[model samples]
Target: MARQQFDLIVFDWDGTLMDSTAHITRSIQAACRDLSVPVPTDEAASYVIGLGLRDALAIAAPSLDPHDYPRLAERYRHHFLLTGVETVLFEGVRELLEELRDRGYLLAVATGKSRVGLNRALDEVQLTRFFDGTRCADETFSKPHPAMLQELTRELGQDLGRTLMIGDTTHDLQMAINAGAAGVAVAYGAHPVDALTALAPRFVAENVPALRHWLREYA
Candidate 1:
């Protein structure tokens, strides 16, 4: 069958749309410090992007005592939300989303963040209005699970083939493939460009501007 034209553009929230890298890492570090565990480096934190908070905490603090994970999770959420005021949207991301919306594509967010965290970030940045729907790991499953993507498609009554998933992580790429949708990986975010490219995305954008251009031409 011919490739279907896309009507829906799904985004990954954290690293792709929002530049919460430092906030996330610092919050995780705070959580570790609260538990007397060693903090992870920024690179290590990057590897945990697109994972649910529970899973991310584990990956970020692998040496932590297992029994303390729940407490760590709570501490991370509290600290992260407090420090999130410092987080900002990626450069050109708002314009890109506006461009996509203006061109009549339905926009949604599929992220590994929980509903609370996702909503907080969106509300903090006042970016929630741009998206028609948001699917978070708390609502379904984490990246690479396809659960959120499937739920979004079902809720929106859109054909899976007519959806495009854009993110900066391999998990997002795998989620798109799992959902039988088009994957476009952004290079200027969390994952290295080469890593995202190796996932074989339909398109790999070097930055938000390039991604916006691609949406104009293809999505």
Candidate 2:
């Protein structure tokens, strides 16, 4: 087998590992309805999946006043919680994580979710042990910013050249670019394959099986 090129693998949570995009889109739309703002189209809602809550709402509802951001965020959380959205990990995700871990690759998460939200999800999935480190947007600058990736690499003591970011969105790829790390894109997540390709990721996997194959062969 070819030597693995990456020692540290950073994952994006939403759209990438978990199948939460539709639930999130509904929650955003519900929040908009609560505030009498125009609900964003499904495309608009999904486009912001990897962004911080406030940043996402702003983009999804650009006409809303900035003063309404806090309320919108609150309503989003409320709606999301009340929706009873089941947390479902993508197919092959657990096996993939386990295989990577067994192969001695360090795993981490850099997500747009708040610290509390990520923690809750991790607990529910019983996946805390799978990740060696994590950075949340509420605790750092949001996605497409290099802060999350930079801090993850720093905390892991891994060089940028030996770290890889895998995510479902352009924001995730752009963040990797900003952090001077290589990236792979998963098309089964938020953005389309074409959009991901435009960012120049090292590889674009169409599904979890393909992702596993790519990681084994090239990561």
lDDT of each: 0.84, 0.93
lDDT of 2 by residue, 74-167 (tens): 9999988875567799999999999999988999999999999999999989899999999999999998999998999889899998899999
lDDT of 1 by residue, 61-153 (tens): 988877888999999888876732665888998888887777777899998888877887788788888998899887777879988888888
TM-score for each of the candidates: 0.91, 0.97
Output the lDDT of residue 51, model 2.
97
The true-structure Cα RMSD of candidate 2 reads 1.1
Question: What is the Å distance of residue 196 in model 1 from its true position?
Answer: 0.6
Candidate 2 lDDT at 142 equals 97
Residue 114 miss distance in model 2 (angstroms): 0.2
Find the candidate with the highest TM-score and give its number. 2
Which pairs of residues collide in candidate 1? none
